[model samples]
Target: MNPAPSHVASRRDKLLILLTVCLAAVLLPLALSGGAVATPAIGRDLGGSPASLTWVTNAYMLSFGSLLMAAGALADQFGRKRLFVIGLGGFIVSSFAISLAPSVFWLDILRAIQGIVSAASLAAGSAALAQEFDGHARTRAFSMLGTSFGIGLAFGPLMAGTLIEYFGWRSLFITTGAIAAVAFMFGVPRMRESRDPNAAGLDYPGTVTFSATLVLFTTAIIQAPESGWGSPLIVGLLAASVVTLVAFIMVETRARRPMLDLSLFKYVRFIGVQILPLGTCYSYILLVVMLPLRLIGAEGMSEMDSGLLMIALSAPMLVVPIAVASLTRWASPGVLSGLGFLIAAAGLYWLSLVDFSASKTALLMPMLIIGIGTGMPWGLMDGLSVSVVPNDRAGMASGIFGTTRVAGEGTGLAIGTAILAALANTSLAHRVPEGGPELSARVAEAAQRLTNGDIAAAAAALPEVSRHALSLSYADAFVGLLHVLIVITLLSAFATFAFLSRTRTQGDGFERDEKGVEAVTRA
Candidate 1:
């Protein structure tokens, strides 16, 4: 490939910037989901328990989601190019370091560091794109970014399976590190430096308090399934989350220059944009994290087979966002977003009806429908979220949007797993009522294993007569969880529809201030 154009002044330079920024976006999800297919192998090799293995994913998410706003604020204060290069370098180093981690503890710690660095890269990279593009070009640039993100998510499992089969799980990190290093090398000299000239000093107190709130809350959610929800530790963590949240709000309110401008919440349009991603990502995460496990464990498919099947769930994401962006001339973004949520809810409802004994092909239509629906709003919402804000605070808006996306995925995974575990246990108890105390213990063990996507172990642990029943119970639990998700998604769809219905035009609900910066207002 030829060298990337030197600066953003020429048309070719603009395309290069988009590609560079999208490279970062793609790398984030690639690093995140690349390990999905390798999780079992990692656990087996590292001697990690199911609960501990989950932290391997959650640790990355917790740190990534928690630091995004602060990272964005820093990017705005410092130059975006400077922070982007630093973040890319950190990601490269941490990715390499993770491959050398001797145990799960060190791996999780390194993954958390990777997440922190990823936050900086994502926020700065996105801000750079926003700075480099405008109008229709901006729309197309965001669409391409969304497409790259979808491609990463769509192909991560396939890549992971192939890499792990050939080179082992360690290669995943090594490959990612090498890619980041290359991107950094190109990004450093070619990328133009940009920062908010009016930005004040970093809001250290607000960042600390806000980060504590997210950490405590996510920790409580992750542990609630293992430790009883009513446990003192869980309760204390919940309480601490609340306290830190209040402290964060107070700090932001009093700060001369807040990390997050709390006043943005007053805009109904901004609120709608924020909620759009949270709702869509919740459902998307469930599919991404759970579907592969379900195929491998419940359906007895090979990792490669499962990865191929996942294409139905993610390929539409690659195509639909660009298509939706093109439709902007015909439909308002609010209309498109609300319709997307409704369609996704319908898809989830359809998925709830699939029979457990059905073949993998039976999942294709619902998965495709859900993928298309999920893709429809992504680029639209992403573009609007940053564009609606002042040009200088684009980083802050991008950070908030990215934070919601990661936080929603983490929250969904925790809740979905808990629901599946609880429901499976309940079904097992009902079906095996006559089993002795030992049998009851065995069934509980099996349910836990099933929740972790070790359906083979779960089945093997049960008596022959109970094995088929266990499969049915697993199916029933999944269906039950799907029903719950469907309901939540439908409620979100209704709210999105209601919010959008109030607007008369594409930008009717927002107004430009005296300085020509957009602000949210009533239609």
Candidate 2:
């Protein structure tokens, strides 16, 4: 075949790469937000039980988390471009199947498949650019990648809400599938094939063992609230998880090409740099997801209004990367991560102070402050993470780093949700009481109403005094969620400071080679 015009080919190739990268990292969140809004509609259409609706989310998470480690190794063995195309094909097919799902059970299964496929694309995209470029160019490339990540995160919810408001839930599946197909077609031909020729054979046992460990651990954590920590199911799962995780570590250490190089944590700088990104996800979920619910249900605000109010959190994230990238020239990642945690913690503390009657405008200041705080860490973590690791390990490091962030987010949500649920139940139940049979029945009914998101029903069922008390209790719930956010942020700050600090002496012997950035270590 005749070689294409150089400029035209290059432009086409770049477009394809950018499209695939954004789709891989951002598509799931966009689909998730849209799907979340459509849970009611999906349940009604499929005749699904209330319990089954949660699967629309859980299934995706399970698969995404399940395949993350394997995807990184696959990208290194199979060509990055080749594996990415395969994953894209799988994603599109699964999405189409989900759109045509006959029932909720089928939809959940397909969503899980979609998650597994998406993780491959995500890992490939992160690794591809670093392998494709040299030294400083790679750093610039990662900045662009980080920017795409922020843009996708910000855009998904807004887009999802608009789509769900107009088209319906299944449209999410259709739209995502269409985008994946187009990107796949455009991406496959022009993209360069980049993979580590020196990489060892795939470590199948390590992949299976690690995946099982994560599954069992997450299941145990998620189930403990409902089943009781002492329940046979919870205790058995937890114990099995510990054994499997230990086995995974041992297995990876001995495997031909370990899915994850546990040795990365040997570098104190690398370990410290990751804590910020790892913990940032937790802050992201609480501020964006939980805060919105609190605003609408507890504070008097419409869903749209709450969404608008919450956009401030993301707005700063968009700009922070530029700020953080620039700051790194002068300061180290440790300085950046430590400062970021402090700012985020301050924002959380302010958030905890907002009461039920607080004004929406009053909430904006703290949100903006937190956003500014978050921007540095968000940007700094990505740049520093790739910078501190060796070229060959970039793919592995990115995979593990991203997984840690996701795990932190999942755990944070579970912890925050559990706290809010407990406080809401206890405070409301006490306010409603075991009194006269008729009064007691009415109060119990109101408590159920509050739990179910029917604030109006709860208000109407309670006596005037009890109504005021329940309102106060809801305020207490918001306070509790905020406190949870505060505690996490504080712990994150300390982790960043104590574990992240380094002297300039240790940073002297470092330089980036043609393949990628140089490794930095701590004193």
Candidate 3:
């Protein structure tokens, strides 16, 4: 066969990559946010204990967040294309398996596998795209990627809800898998293979310790309400999590080929980049999970109705990020991101004050504000994450940021859910006449069911507690959670403005190479 012109080949490759990435971005968050809305359906179809059902989300978040570091390193060591293909293949199979799952136990296990492979594909695919652009163009590409992610999150609930309403909950998984398959097919033929020969092998010890740390800590948080925070098992898990975390830091510092370069901590901008995800976790992600619970469980809305209402909360993400990206020409991303947070904080505070008894339209302004605020930082954070590091370390940078982002969601979900449950549980216990220690476990379980948007299940668990009472208690707890998110958003805004600098993106940038030689990387 005759060789094609270089420019023609390049254009073809870029187009194919764009298609695949957009699809991947959409499907990833579709699975996460969509699954959040689908929980009530899952619980109804497959009966399981409250703890087991929590694992339906936790299992995926746990594995996905924990293994990202290793996947990034593997991408750099092996070929990026090679790992990307493998990851997508695994994702397709696992998502399909999840669709046909017989019980929640199998679903949790499959979701875990799905998360693991997703880490691989996300790290490799993002790093591969980074290799193709530099300077403002790089920022634009990543901004596009971020926008695609927003679209997924924006539509995930409505799409999933609509699918579950008509087809079945299982169809959501099938849809995710089918979209992924197209990305695989288009990307495989046109994408060029690349790798960093300098990358050291995966740090197995670091992976194990880090994974163990998350497992122990998240388990402790999720199970604490039922078991009691002071219970021996919960205490032991917390202690072990602390120990493993310390061990992970030690292992990374001492290893010749650490999965994470501890040196990245020294850069203020890098630290700022990491903070952006955590900020979004509370301000945005928490809302995506909990709002549905309130709408469906407390307000007695159908899946389709709640999903439609959610468009107000998530729709700003679709446009605001792109606007912020363009606005960066006039303002530093730091200033824009911080401003966004303040806007979001304003919305969150308003949302807290708004009476749930009012029409749903009253909810729109605050949700839109919150989405716009978070979107500003969201657009730029993706580019900044990799831009702060050398191109050679793109996989590792993506991996580290990916880990922080996903792990934040995992921990945030656990913390947010636990807090909401605890508050509601206490409210329920108080409502119970002469309720004592014997009533605590059932009340806690009922509270969890309430937060999961299973008000009927919650009422069933606490037969003595009126369904109306349970709904009121949950609404109060959710509103309180919103107040907490507002404060976090404000802090995030201040930190963003204070810590991030234009130097990382526009000024002369340098990083020490493997041999201690400082080299100027692309701005």
**Top candidate (lDDT):** 3
Cα lDDT tens digits, model 1, 325-425, are: 77877777767877887888888888888874677688889988888888877657777776555565665676677677777676667677777878887
- The TM-score that candidate 1 achieves is 0.88
**Candidate 3: segments with Cα more than 4 A from true spot:** 1-10, 131-140, 386-399, 501-523
> Stretches of candidate 2 above 4 Å error?
1-4, 32-55, 99-106, 131-137, 192-195, 295-306, 356-359, 386-395, 434-474, 503-523
List, residue by residue over 1-523, the lDDT tens digit for candidate 3: 5556887888778878877876787888887877778778898999777777777777888888998878878888898889988888899999999999999989989988988998888878888788776888776777677778888889888998898888988999998999899889888677778888877778999999999999999999998887889999999999999999999999999988787777666655678879899898888988887787678667877788888988988998888877777887787777888888888899899898887766888998888888888888887787778766656665457667878989989998999888888888877878788767767778888888887878889988899988889878887887778888888889998888777756346323654554322333111
lDDT for each residue of candidate 2 in 402-502, tens digit (9 for 90 to 100) = 77766555455545555565566567667654668566555545544443334565677676445557778767766776777767777877887776554
Model 1: how far is 289 from its true place, Å? Answer: 1.2
Candidate 2, run of 10 with poorest lDDT = 514-523
Clashes of each: 0, 0, 0
| Whole-structure CA lDDT of model 3 | 0.82
Which structure among the candidates has the greatest TM-score?
3
How many steric overlaps does candidate 3 have? 0
What local distance difference test score does each model get? 0.76, 0.67, 0.82
The model with the greater TM-score, 1 or 2, is 1
